[model samples]
Target: MPFFVPVGRRLSAALGLCLALLCLPAFAIDAAPADADPAPIALDARRATISLDGRSQQLLDPTGALGIDDIAAGPPGLNWRLRGAGERTVLSGQTALWLRFDVLMRDTQAHWELELARSGTDAITMYYRDAQGQWRVQRAGDRLAVSDWANPDRYPVFSLDVRPDETVRYWVRVEHARVPFSGVFQLHDHNTLREQRIHQQFVLGAYFGMALLLTVVALANMAVFRDAAFATYAIYISLLGLSMAASLGVGGQFLWPNLVRWNQEAEFVLLPLMGLVGLMFVRQVAQPRRIGRTLDRLCLALAAAWLIGIVWDQSLPSALSLQALSALGTLSMLTIAAMLGLAWRSGETWIRWFAVSMVPVLLASTLPVLRNFNLLSSNFLSQYGIVIAASIEAPLLFYALLMRSRIQHETQARAHALERTEPLTGLTHRPHFLLRLHDSLVRAQRYGHHSALLLVHLHNHAEIAARHGREVADRALVIAASQLRAVARDVDTAARLDDDSFALLIEGPVKPDQVLHTATSLLANGLRLSPRLPAGTTLRLRVVAALLPDADSELAQDAAAHLEWMRQGMLTLSEEPRKAILRLNF
Candidate 1:
């Protein structure tokens, strides 16, 4: 306290001490061991292949202004980080990435190729020094036409030439603007690479062939059944197959090799379009209105949003577009998941099959999106996951469609049957009976085939109803219906035309004698006693048979007029005798 220094001098001393403390660590770090250069990967007769991903170092060019010279000069503080074990090099944001690795050749005769195990990069440039000590550049990617690539292939490939016992350092510049790029770097001999490509192509061809077969089946169903569900499924599968082709680089390599711009943009456009169509297919098949109006509207709204996303993706920058598409894809999957839950809760049993089929595809489809978003590393699962999953999903989905179609067909059949048949007797009602008669008459006229219509009248139906009750009268009508059905053959049509009149159309190849025999059988059956009727009550029937479509008859062509002729014949027979059979030509 007694030896106080000046205030300015005290502050200066404390600042000097703080500066020295900060400088001390910097000096110590500089004096510490420097990081050694990574050893060159050796490729010899015993080991002709190696994975460059583990041996490489990566540098990010934020502004994308760095050139080969700048990278070669080893600028200070531009630290190149080593790739960790099993780590994939991922290109993200708006930045370009540079990868450096060295390969030592032991066998001079072997031709080598470096392969980037992915196909959707925007541009990839490989830089190396040749024997003459000049920098050589080779380019390949979706941005460049496949025909113009240094090596036209499903993946970016580069030829490597080096002398025996020489170590060649390589610099790979990867720029993917629209999406994140993550891939494995492999050095394979030329023959081995070709074999790999052939195997890959075979597997992909099998998958696409299966997809095409399923799509053809769907289209055939659409045409035959005229169902919107089948049509929507066909479109969805087609777009999904095309999108897979584009993502796998098969489209660029074989489909449209010269369309560089379209090749670059195809994946982005097709993926969302697939989602849109897939939603439509789901809605058409699910018929969510059976569950609730809210679910139906949700499906429509989701489809519209996906459609909007397809257009919006084109307007955004490459990175932003990828991000947006990835987000939308996630939302789409979530929407499907939610629909599955709602369907389950609402007891949509058919949707259970749909939900089960979606599991593998959903899991497989998510890997690529995660890889695109840099949330997952590139691997076999991320690259070919959809292909494997689609192979399983396609067949399952086709089966689901078949089940749904069968259920719908059965439902429609039941509804139609209810509309056309009489409720009490389960026989063709009056309107449908006339329609069948008209069809039969037209066929008989066209083919010159003989056919007959028999009109049978219950003579005492009103007398029984007045004596017993309406129930007893209904029982008599039912018993009468059973007799007519028993008398009719498989090719014949039976109908309850009115309160007491029944009609039977015996289909073609019949003569008047056969018609007379049929009429006598009906009269005999009508006189039989039935336990279902009142005690001591026997049915009395007046029968009239009309042979159809007579060449000289004016009313032969008209089914209604011919049926009226049969009725008049029945009325005439009623006045003449009891239990009499009357046969007429019409």
Candidate 2:
């Protein structure tokens, strides 16, 4: 193995290690004890926030046959236990769990709002006594439509009117088909609740606005540059925005209030689409050619599988789709990390910047999955991390795209410039030079300014090319062009007329004597090199100079006629072989 392979591979290894460590937070969630419980939350303030995880009493019935009423009635032999202390409570298995807590408010003027900060719950029914001693019931969860929600908030909000010095008992019956991850339950006054909602809306708007801006920028890049990668990136960003909006409940409440089913299934739809387009965008930007064909094909296959899951979502169970989503999300993150590492190893420097840009979003994308698997506690960071990360990562990704685009544009421009240039001499080619010469002649004729043309022919270029190969021949031509440029003025046009011929057009009223002097100087320079030329290889210079006559002179009236006269003089000089320079004195 070589000592210095590509830096990309080494970076890839480092990135893998870093990402593995990143997954630790997710794994830490599983380490939380099933029986772990936090101490009871004391109602110490008129407005306060608390987690109901282990602070409340919990009774789990695996059969899900026990209701809140049954639990409150005190089953003679039924088991009733206090919930264990933990950062988050995970009620595993298909069961009904009843949680009970008592709240004592000291301020009579304080109107309480109890909010369950968790989302995606299958069903949650609350039992509480109001101020009039009437038992009231409130139903809220994924099972109910957003429009039918009691408070019209994304999460369930229960208004409480507890009298001063009065202790009220609350029971919540929770049922889920899969493992349920509990969140922090908060109790606060109207002002606190309003402030929180305002904060949430601000975050959501920033997140969605950033995503929208990125999408628009990507689309504009796609349209202007005709890059397919930008189009895919645009789609990816759009899906991310949709996912954020739907998950935050803003999309349901505002964007599509009538589309209840769409709101419920928004995550399922947007994530898969984001995954698919995200893979495509990664492949394109990372330069699959350098990352290896096998890896590229694998990314495509995974993207295709995610697409299939999205298409078949209607026929499959929601749980199956959700499970598939978590699996694919983890897989996608791993795959991206691997590909980025491989890209770095392959010597793709741009991928390094991209890797840096993806860090926040990668962490954001993983936290929710970990929370879903009960590997991380559910909170604002886990639930809304994508939006938070997107707000930061969007601009960074856009910068990466811009950098990549600029590099591509420069590369294309260089290639286009080379097409009109002679590679050996670094000067315009014969056709391009001729067009310039004709244009110069036309301008001089129209503007009534005198111009001088100096043509030099290297008669031995063929012998040198054949004897020493093209590399040596190319060096000799470059040397000759350099000599021509050194003596030419800044406004003068210097070009390669053919394989061994060169020309210079001086844009001024130069005398015939001046043209003769310029031609003589080039002859004396002798187009010769020192170190690398073959011992006997030498170049013979044939020079021709002409001063264009006026429209009334013996020569033809047009610029074409002046060019013909110079060409004829060069041909005549070629036939002589003995002539070194021909000066046409008009």
How far in Å is the alpha carbon of 151 misplaced in model 2?
2.8
Reference-based TM-score, model 2 = 0.77
- For this target, which candidate reaches the highest lDDT against the unseen true structure? 1
lDDT of 2 by residue, 1-586 (tens): 8887554455445545654665565545432223433343445453356555546776667777776567778778665556543345445556777777777767556567778786666667888878876778888766677677667677778776556677778888876554345666667776778888899888677777777877888999988877777888888889888877776667766777666667667766776677677777777777665636887788888888887777777467455566676788777776776666666655445666776677667667776566556566666776777777777777778877777777888888778888887777778776676666677766766777777888788877788888889888887777778778887889787888777788888876667777788888787776454566677665578888876544455653454456667678789898987788987665
Q: Give stretches of model 1 more than 4 Å off.
A: 1-34, 45-49, 85-94, 293-301, 318-321, 346-349, 406-426, 431-451, 457-491, 507-509, 516-586
lDDT of each: 0.79, 0.71
User: lDDT score of model 2?
Assistant: 0.71
lDDT of 1: 0.79
Q: All predictions: root-mean-square deviation over Cα?
A: 14.0, 5.3
Error of 2 at 53 (Å): 3.9
